[model samples]
Target: MRAMVYRGPYKIRVEEKDIPRIEHPNDAIVRVTLAAICGSDLHLYHGLMPDTRVGMSFGHEFIGVVDQVGASVQNVQPGDRVMVPFNIFCGSCWYCARGLYSNCHNVNPNATAVGGIYGYSHTCGGYDGGQAEYVRVPFADVGPALIPDWMSEEDAVLLTDAAPTGYFGAQLGDIAQGDTVVVFGAGPVGLVAAQSSWLMGAGRVIVIDHLEYRLEKARTFANAETYNFTEYDDIVVALKRQTDFLGADVAIDAVGAEADGNLLQHVTSAKLKLQGGSPVALNWAIDSVRKGATISVIGAYGPIFSAVKFGDAMNKGLTLRMNQCPVKRQWPRLFEHVHNGYLKPSELVTHRVPLEHIAEGYHVFSAKLDGCIKPLVVPTAA
Candidate 1:
């Protein structure tokens, strides 16, 4: 088998590796058929995530065909097509029983906050991800679901992470019928959040980004107002003016640790590693929303302190709701949305790279070249 081996920051290559076998009774071996390189994977590529060891594969959003299953695995069989959620968990744990699979207590030694995630670093459980020819899926019954017969492979792969997380962000906003929603990022997740906000009955949606290309994508894809933050002196103030000086009814921070805006914050956090992540986007969300409104955070962040405006949030009585999305929990409804043609997740797929050249794929995405929004990985096994 071949996999994307992480050597260090900005260093990855396709290397031959041992094919993972079923190690637990509930485990299954999946021959990856379709997979995606998520934006969160860039944090690992840039050496931001703690304890991401070399030689580990980095990918979490994937759909595959089952190759083998452990004795206790019953939900899927050999040759069955399945989409594996990013969250790895046991079905019967306290969190899983409560539909909080992302917080399952039985999966990770570092299970204090996030549960086991495929291909994230040791901080989230050192499970290898699916950016390869094959991947080992633990607790197969709980996290792996059969791809609906009519769903496209691209949609199924997106549902594994980007779509669900974006939908979850909107779900957390608790948007009222006539509310205004603003998303601070125009990446796939942010675009999806903006698109999903309309489904929740938002009266207006606005997406913010520094890139003209992404803002353009948001305008066309989400059919929402777009703001290029670089053109404005103070984006938050500009946002307030658009909202009649009160502020948006809800704000979503889809840009996490790697957010750019404040020079010092990006320098200290992303460059120097002095802070967990840059809080520029999260802070913007706090300042750009109405005093008593809600803020939803679906951005990927390190498990450390950030320079967020906690004081302002408390003072304004804002409702701060965020988590590593319980990906599977959003599937049932998401499946219907895709089936009904409300969204075409495949429209977000702007590039496709083979496993042999994934290093180039990472470079193109990280550099934001070629108007790249989302890049899918085509493993040899596919």
Candidate 2:
């Protein structure tokens, strides 16, 4: 099997590796058909996440055919085509019973925070991801769902992470009828968040980013007003002005770790590794929303200290909600939305690269070249 292995910061290559075998009674071995390089993967690629060991594969959004299943894996069979959520969890765990699958206590040894995530990093759980021909799926009965007959492979893959996280961001905002929502970042997650806001009854949606292509996608795909923060003297003030000086009813920070508005913050967090992640987007979210409004943060950040505006949030009575999304929890409604043609997740996919060319794929995506919004990885076996 060929798997994308992380060598060091800014270094990755597809190398031959052993296909993972079932390790537990509930485990399954999946032959990956479609996998995506998520924007969050860039954090790991750039050495932002802690405990990301060399030789580890990095991917969490993937769909595949069940190549083999342990005796206890009754929900799926060897031939089943399935979409696996990013989170690996035991369904009967306390958190899982409450629909908080992302925080399942029984999976990761370091379950003080996030649960097991496929191919994320050791901090989340040192589980190998599906950025290869085959991946080992633990607690297979609880995580892998058969792909719906009507769903496209591209859509199924996105639903594994990006789509659900975006929807979860919107849900965290608790947008009321006729509320104005502003989303920071126009990446796939931000675009999906902006689009999902409309479905949640937001009266208006606005997306912010530095890139013209992504902002353009926000305008067309989410039907939201777009802003290039690079063009503004103070983006928060600009957002306030756009919201008639009161500020937006809700604000979401979808850009994490490598946010690039403040040079000092970016340097300290992203370059020097002093802080967990750059707090520019989060601070902007706090300042751009109304005093009593909500702010949702779905951006991936390191599990360390970050310079945030906690004082201001408390003073303004803002409801700040954030978590690693429970991906499977959002699937029922998301499936309905996709089935009804309300969303075309595949439309966001800009490039598809073979596993052999994945290093180039990473480079293009990291450099933001060729208008790469979302890139998919197709294994040779697929």
* Full-model lDDT for every candidate: 0.93, 0.93
The ten-residue window of minimal lDDT in model 1 covers 105-114
Off by over 4 Å in 1: none
lDDT of 1 by residue, 1-382 (tens): 9999999999999999999978899999999998999999999999999999999999999999999999998889999999999999898999899999999999899647889999999998999999999999999887899998999999999999999999999999999898999999999999999999999999999999998999999988899999998999999999999999999999999999999999999988888878889999999989889999999999988987888999999998999999989998899999999898877788999999999999999999999999999999999879
lDDT digits (tens) for residues 110-213 of candidate 2: 54688999999999889999899999999988898999998999999999999999989999999999999999999999999999999999999999999999
Q: What is the clash count for each candidate, in the order shown?
A: 0, 0
| Model 2 misplaced stretches (Cα beyond 4 Å) | none
Predict model 2's lDDT versus the native: 0.93
Q: Model 2 — which ten-residue stretch has the worst lDDT? A: 106-115
Clashing pairs in 2: none
